[model samples]
Target: MKRSETFTTVLTEAHAGSRIDLVLSQVFPEISRNQIQNLIKAKKVLMNGKVPKPRDIVEGGEEVSLEIEIDEGVSAPEPQAIALDILYEDDDLLIVNKSAGMVVHPGAGNPNNTLMNALLYHYPPLKDLERAGIVHRLDKETSGALVIAKNEETAEALQKQFAERTVTRVYQALLVGELISGRTVDAFIGRNPYNRKKMMITEYDEELEENPGKEAITHIRVLERFREHTLVECHLETGRTHQIRVHMQHINLPIVGDPDYGSRLKIPRKFTHHAENVLRGFRRQALHAYQVGFIHPKTGEDVLATAPLPKDMTTLIDAIREDHELYVKDHF
Candidate 1:
């Protein structure tokens, strides 16, 4: 389904000298700045019946009108009766604990048995939403809480929160090396120029170059440290592809079991057999989206969700702790 909407607003003196796109985004908080810019580029927005540039300054008393055609119904994927670890659900949205190895949506080589498929099976109405109401996504090997909107309005609202950087996301990971203290990684992330499959942390100004990358930031706090590994909590300031993994690797702390960014398979000579086995056998990135918090799109209330560590990670941490204790006793 598709529909058209028209909105008109009169600017005040306070808005004078601001860019048209910026002013419109402030006027319509639910819509994103990118969307507003796209509308301007497409000539769907008019100031006194004339298409205005995005950078055009807005003056007081100007009549701004915006007309846009939105696709109300999105093409949904096939519904599959896959199980979902649902944490919270309401009329507006749902919070799900996405398990590792589960792809959030269908892509090349994976067309079924995804979270989107399962969502459609449980809520048929989601078929009308974009990406089956998935406002954000978790990588296939990352496990944790994720938000799914129930309708277009809610989806747009939640998406705006993400764009505005108002949503909070915290992840837990076991990096390969011991980190003494907390640190922040502020860099630009872009697909590797040599290998498109991997992400690289480039200079912050890389965004001004070809194949521009987006700004990415991750704050890491050491939770526990072992002789050979560190368990840390990561707070994402900007969400980008392979953000945590790439940022950790940038600091030479690539996550354990991360096939793409992990260090070569080598165990410390002094490590216990069990600890070595746990690290060697791990098959996926030791990263989880443990917590997510955002404002409710409909109720305007703060909503937070947390997911417990999966069994594999918990087991690995236990082994690391035991090995560290034994090593300390022997050395002392």
Candidate 2:
């Protein structure tokens, strides 16, 4: 899947003063400036029969040949004897519905007892696959469908599709309040200067905006509304750090039980709308990656997987319903 595409631009005086990276950015915005520099370093980017340096100035009407390298991206972790849910498994790939509260992979302080640990224990052969066995990730709190790579080749393909935003992931959340009937929180998001741990809606400033992140789009629609809660469905256009949670908070409606970005609503820990809101005793972010769809890495065939709400989420929903119903009957 390593394919190369070319672009030839007639650099005008408009492009003369700009650096090669900036100049190409205007011509080829789909590719990043760093990627362009990578081609130059690899001697794949030539200007007038020579490898033009990064800072080199391009004159008007110069032909720039770019031999871009395209590879599907995949990531893996240190292999260990991790026991996986193993909803589906084969030689090429597998799909598993992660439970709530399980960290997807190993990280600071959580080196063991993670999804990676279970995965490692399940697929000892994945030692060679590395993160290739881990194609997509679910946040430690968010539970739902994830695709795992069995080998390096499958990992690469899944990574590429995820990077290009071709994969479809659907997350359901219970917000603190009733949201607009149908809404899309279309706003630019930046890191919180005040808190390194959070992303927030940032003001527009040249200095802060220069190297800002790309467009993050979210489509949200209210599914159900209780007295003080709103169940909503979210579709993500770009997968940035905490995209759904940040966008929801940016609009002043954070997910129920989300520690960092959620608006604090005074409710019992029993929250969330998963399991179609039928159970009780649920806590956590109240967000679930319920469904995922994509093309199979090797077969290129459409694939879709759905995960039901975990017991914790379902239990909480049912408890809330019974509690509220009883309260209303007694009060009336």
Best by lDDT: 1
lDDT of 2 by residue, 1-332 (tens): 56675555445554565567656644554455567778788888777778888878766667787776555332335556645565666678889888877887666667667887777777777667644377666778898888988887787677667756788988888777667587887776655767765667655569633444435788887777665667788887666667888888877788877888875546534343443244323458888887788888777788888888777665655555565565567668
After superposition, candidate 2 runs with Cα above 4 Å error = 1-82, 130-132, 208-211, 268-282, 323-332
Q: Which stretches of candidate 1 lie over 4 Å from their true place?
A: 1-76, 204-211
- In the range 27-128, model 1's lDDT, one tens digit per residue, is 664455568889998889999889999878877779999997856664436999988898889988999999999999876678788999999999999998
What's the lDDT for candidate 1? 0.85
Question: lDDT (0-100) at residue 289 of candidate 2?
Answer: 83
Clashing pairs in 1: none
True-structure Cα RMSD, model 1: 6.2
How far is 127's C-alpha from truth in model 1 (Å)?
A: 0.5
Worst 10 residues of 2 by lDDT: 272-281
